[model samples]
Target: MPPTHLRRALAVSATAAALTVPLLGAAPAEPAARVASAAPVVPVVPAVPVVPADVVDDYYADAEGLTGEPLKQALHEIISTDVTTLTYSQVWDALKVTDRDPADPDSVILLYTGLSRDADANGGNVGQWNREHVWPQSHGDFGTSPGPGTDLHHLRPSDVQVNSDRGNKDFDEGGTESPRAPGNYTDADSWEPRDEVKGDIARMALYMAVRWEGGDGFADLEVNDSTGNGSVPYLGRLSTLLDWHAQDPPSAAEEARNATVFEDFQGNRNPFVDHPEWVEEIW
Candidate 1:
């Protein structure tokens, strides 16, 4: 007879072997040594895809080789041309499509909370999503008019309370982490979006600054280096926004949202989304 310890090991191995065997000869059972030494399975995470080059070909042709104010001007001209505006009412339907969750066709992704909620769950009640103006309409006092007020490029669905928490606050780093929306922080004067969408917020601000150059009846939106912009046609902490733009490059989802706005809802695109490098070039 085998030694006591050796016999115990053999018994356990025999049970494992028996359990692993197929009722009908499915295939030979893996050797005990092979099974014991096998590596743990790691789930594969797919890489974020990039927008095809052809989609942006000649779209920014007029803004090429330009920098600073000239570049800003060129991009504004490029994106502002023939934009189809939606009504404040239509924003509900447009956001259902623009910010729709990729994994769930019936849901849309909330901006600050990153929660995927049902498309129809929009209202002023708690625990629901509503349109969030990336560039607060009050800062520029655009209200809910059909122009900048309804621009799909800047509007997104966000949790109701989270939207109010971020109300009219400028973007910056550091604050107490929000209880309602983790990863986001807020101070008296500024609201810092979560890291994943920090670049998205920054790009939206930059796009607003460029697209609304005070040429139209609306206020001339601009970016500044300070906070507490309060009803002014400016958003701030530009230096921080620039840092965010570099830290978080455009994601595949963001690029797709830009394309949807251009191809379906809005007739124009957010240039910064298409060409992130142009942010530093102009700002």
Candidate 2:
């Protein structure tokens, strides 16, 4: 489901944004019911039937010439404003997109152990669940227009501090310096990019940086630069770990847990977690 703020981003009709739902993880089956005790429930549409490979290829081709930030913009434009009547958030909300938590082993069993589900099982939140742009919006990438397909890249829910520390800088294997936001506290050493979720963060960041290469708004953002003050570290450890993760994806167990958590909270599926083949299989 799209955030309230994102819904406003697309002031036109709210049809598409309203359809988001969870993609991976453990969420209650009856989605419409409220969860006051938990994170606010954002309404969204159920998953669109997975498109056939040929259709997917066609869609990918349509998205061709789009990569880095420009590609992301293209995707955002398609979802939020391109359609005129349909907002990006509306589409995402109706679908339910979420990020996964590989830290929890039970996460997989709680949802689905593999791509195949049991008779009684279903996927968790992939929407509404935060697919954080490793490169932040503050730096100005796609302008927060949430939707499915190519737009989905550059997002992955992660620890708030982790996201804050990253702040649109590119993921580098070298150490990093402190953030310009002085109050932002990130103990580069304490920050563990090796953490299960870190891998997800790394891949998403790389994808976004490549997608938004030429967007006028993001040129100033130093995607791969350090703070220069020697406070952050050389390349952020998280950035380096992400490189490794992308080269070698998590194990089946990691995939399951991330998928489960994503399902429960956001309401959608992770193409990376679901189909490892989409990326190089080093891990």
lDDT of 2: 0.34
Instruction: Write model 1 residue lDDT over 1-283, tens digit each, in one string.
Output: 0112222322334222222110010112223454332211111121432234665767778888999889988888888886767799988977776665544556666777565678889999987789899999988899998888888778988889989999999999999988777778999999998776788888888988988888669999999998999999989999999999899887656776676576656667888888888887887
lDDT of 2 by residue, 43-110 (tens): 22234322234533443343455444454444433323222222444433322322212222111111
On a 0 to 100 scale, what is the lDDT of residue 211 in model 2?
A: 36
Model 1: how large is the Cα RMSD against the reference? 18.5
Q: Which parts of model 1 are misplaced by more than 4 Å?
A: 1-52
Worst window of 10 by summed lDDT in candidate 1: 18-27
Task: Assess the local accuracy of residue 272 in candidate 2 as a C-alpha lDDT between 0 and 100.
Answer: 45
lDDT assessment of candidate 1: 0.73
How does each model score on lDDT? 0.73, 0.34
Q: What TM-score does structure 2 among the candidates reach?
A: 0.39
Pairs in steric clash, model 1: none
